[model samples]
Target: MSWNKLLCNLRELQLSGTLNGGQSFRWEYNKEMDEWTGVFSKTVWKLRQREEFLQYKVIGSLLQSIVQKKNDVEFDNNGVFEGLLKKYFRLDFNLSDYYTKWSEKDDLFKAACKQFYGIRMLAQEPVENLFSFICSQNNHISRISSMVEKLCKHYGEEICEQDGVTYYSFPDVEKLSTPKVESELRQLGFGYRAKFIQKSAAQILEWEGEKWFAGLQDMKYKEARLELMKLCGIGPKVADCICLMSLNHLEALPVDTHVYQIAAQNYLPHLRGKKNVTEKMYSEIGDHFRSLYGDYAGWAHTVLFCADLKKFQQTTDSEDIKPKKRRKKT
Candidate 1:
């Protein structure tokens, strides 16, 4: 298959950080090929980065015909795919501009930018983002990813098979809302999250059907977050996550334990030594970031969050120390 190109800079968007950085859990990296394969918008995609552009290939069948009709666009297949990719990665928003503004206001963000550039927030589909985060409570990324994969394998429709591995689209609300889904998910090792997934799906269907999430984009941030919290197992944090990631509420920040630590150490020292983040503390942390970074506080929080991750820390440490050791030897 021919690789299609999207003009993108490495400094503006890094696939390594954005794809696997706990936002969405579907992407799998192939070390040898240096590419990522994932499913979204009912299509499987393989993507890699070149110096000045992103190279991508459609792996299997696509459901973009509906998208084309909705947008009333007569573009070719590649054009439609390109539009989807742009929307998914949110390429319209200039990350460099945000980085400049963030760095100017906060010294920590300025420091984080040294080693953590190109961490863009993904504009994920609301249905996928909702359930994926429902699985994230008190869990790590690796396990959350496994559970999400199982959901697709069991409930989602098969898109295609590549290299002896099958890929499935994330199941729609109707599919997940069936009476038996909860029990089946528990058997699949979803544990307590199984109920959340099934109940949330059923709630979506009952409240406003599949198109309900689209309505959230038109609401204010606080209003949208409250609407999400009305679902089972969705708390303030998960609600904020869905709001920022899928609902286009850029100011919404999800204050989890990791985020709380970051806030305590740098932004809110008064929160230091606090064992748990209370509801009030959560508001404080998020509000501080919003005050600091303004509209795109969640996006800024992601950059700092990525910088604090052990994976990125190890990479930064290696790069920083290797050259210094070489210099000393020389």
Candidate 2:
């Protein structure tokens, strides 16, 4: 397979913000080389953005960790790679127009947009979104990424080997459904999430495979979430994530702990009077965004969420003054 290079306006597309912005977390950034290596669509590749010009190398066939002379497949200056990148990043959509419109809607959203300006929601694969969110329960971004990478390396087919390092694709649903897969994940420190991953895969298999997950894209947001809830470990939050990121449910708002705080501070200030937000409060927050931001509510909520995460990074990380309560994910 050949890969193509896409050079675009830096203001509209920034790899540091979009890739490192923390939506889908499979890409591994090599600081020394200034490159990011990751697998998507079952192909392993390397990319580096030089100002406006995006350079790439398609080191094909994930099944081989060690590559000889002939086995190496390369992609360059072709429609195949260009189409893939366009579809992956949703480049057809003009994000600047969205930013302008969203900023006009609310002052808070306006402020958040200013901070993480070029961040765009990625259209992740359904299987990857399903299992990745499964691993995300009771976990943070960094660990969630590690667990996802481990799942790929263990069950996925190897793509290629570079500098003694091998990259693999995300494991297939059938490959992940067996009893042994859950056991392997347990040993890999998946903890309680191991059960969720295996059980979810089993449920998908019972539904007659990929079409079950594919059909989700055609359904309404509430309906899709209900169907997703049938799988183990998928709650309102995770369901919303799968919907918004991959299933084209742009209005879905994943009310995680961070969003809960933002709601308490800004939109739902009545939440301050209570110890924790109830189900009613969660619905209120999601509904609030749905009403305010309209169609692209999910996209707006994502930038705000990332902005909130960035805010926490600048805060002091000491717990000496007072005891902290573990706020459950709403």
Candidate 3:
């Protein structure tokens, strides 16, 4: 249960309420307080996620939140530590099989998969996830994250400050389900996504809407994803992201530009030439990965996605690539 030696690179994990599909966050540790506080946990739950192995420090509030939430359960470092370890590292799907198959060709990809992509699981919060993905359509990460932050700051409650940083809690249904708020968000630069987020929030706040979302909880993976797609700003890819990350549907595949690139060069070469990517093609590509890697389709997606990102960064002329210096033994 003691995780003093377990996790490292705490920023990689998406403890934030919104899943932007990009692993970029803003959290700084307070050495004096010895507590990690931010909008989300911002604690790296997976230890083997990075090339360098470092000691994992326990954040007091995050552990306390879990303990306090559980009825009749007392707060103990051991119990809290164990709960987090299980939550992050314990995979319902097998990784060994996926890793072995992926590692066959490129050793670099294998290492990238195991180290970076493997641990970066999506934590999807239904409403927030829905809006985040909506914000992501035909948009960039920097812009998407900024828009999300704007919405949260404008609409969400100001929880408290930690180390001079003000962290805004995610807005609830009540605050977001109004026409006035939706209009304000549009003015704040959400553009098309603002309308969808506002309408979706309004629907979720409705009486019948609760039942609709509740029903999705017990539905099958495909059914649940399909149901989510009914909401405004919910497309096939967006719905799949919500299902896999937030709804606990492990096999869900959310295709985007990066995944499309992988499908072209790596997976399906013939489909690469298509000018427009259709639903049938996307489903076929998902099936291909599922068939080849079996249950680790999501895992493979993460691996390939991260590998593609790294390759893209390396090849881009805008960014400078420098050699990584080796750390000397302590």
Candidate 4:
């Protein structure tokens, strides 16, 4: 099958890091194929990158039927899926320009950008983003991902299957709001988050239905965050996460331990050696980044957060080290 291409720079859209990073947890990389497959925006996508293009394949019965019929599908001609990809990836944003601006303003960001370019924030679905972060409370990426997959498998509608693997769309609020959902999720290893997921879904449905999330997009950053906090399991951090990731609030910075450490080490010296991040400290850290990075402080924070991750530590260690000189002895 022929692949469709979106003209993209590697420095602006590194698929490996962006897809598998903590923002969204659905993508799986195939080492042999040098590609990634993930379910998002209600469809499965297989993506890879060449020098200056992001190559993609839409994998599903409906899309594949159209592709087989057309033989060579041009995204320009078929706008729906293409548009979804563009919006989901926030393709309209010029990340390179932001990188330059951020690098000029902050030395730490400039340094981190050296190894962590192309870590753009994904505009994920709010429902998916909400539950995923609920699972993220005191959880690692691997486990959060596992719980998310279970949520889809058990409650979500099956979208399609490929190569013996089935893809499921994230469950809708109604589907997740069942009376038995909490118990079922507990049995499926969701732990305490089971109640959060179920109750939040129910609350959302009761308040204004599924469209409530769309309404959040139209709200100011603070307003949207306050609204999200009204739901079960959503606190300041998770609310900020949903706002930045889904509700079009780029300025919303979610301060977890990772972000707090980043701030203490490079920006806020007084925060160093603090045993816990108090509510006052959290607001202070967020305000500091907002002042430094402006409207897209959350976006900027994501880059530094990715740079600080242990998986990427090897690059930081090797690249940042300077070789010793021995020629003086000779």
Better lDDT candidate (2, 3): 2
The TM-scores of all predictions, comma-separated, are 0.91, 0.87, 0.72, 0.89
lDDT of 4 by residue, 248-287 (tens): 8999988876677788998899999987778899899999
After superposition, the stretches of candidate 2 with alpha carbons farther than 4 Å from their true spots are: 1-4, 62-77, 312-329
Ranking by TM-score: 1, 4, 2, 3
What CA root-mean-square deviation does each model show from the true structure?
Answer: 6.8, 4.9, 7.9, 8.0
lDDT values, one for every candidate: 0.83, 0.76, 0.57, 0.80
Clashing pairs in 2: 2-75, 3-75, 3-76, 62-158, 62-159, 63-158
Off by over 4 Å in 1: 64-75, 310-330
**Stronger candidate by TM-score (1 vs 4):** 1
Report, for all candidates in order, the number of backbone clashes: 0, 6, 1, 0
lDDT score for residue 66 of model 1: 66
* Candidate 1 accuracy as lDDT: 0.83
lDDT by residue (1-330, candidate 1, tens digit) is 999999999898898778756788788777778888889988999999988999999998547566667879764778878998999999999989889999999999999888888998999999989988888777755677788889888888898999999999998888899889999999988898889889999999998865688788899999999999899999898899899999999999988777888889887888899887888998899899999999999999888877777343332222321211111000
Worst window of 10 by summed lDDT in candidate 1: 321-330
Candidate 3 stretches with Cα past 4 Å from truth are 1-38, 41-74, 77-98, 101-117, 207-214, 314-330
Cα-lDDT of candidate 2: 0.76
True-structure Cα RMSD, model 3: 7.9
Residues 1-330, model 2: lDDT tens digits? 333568766656666666755467677677677777777877777777776667777776542333333456653334565667777777878988988988898899898877677777788889998898888777666677789999999989877787898888899999889989888899999999999999999899999877987788888888998899899888888888889888888898887666788888998787766666677877899999889889889888878876766644411221220111111235
Across residues 151-223, which tens digit of lDDT does each residue of candidate 3 receive? Answer: 7788876655544755566677778888997779878988877888888888777746556666776888889
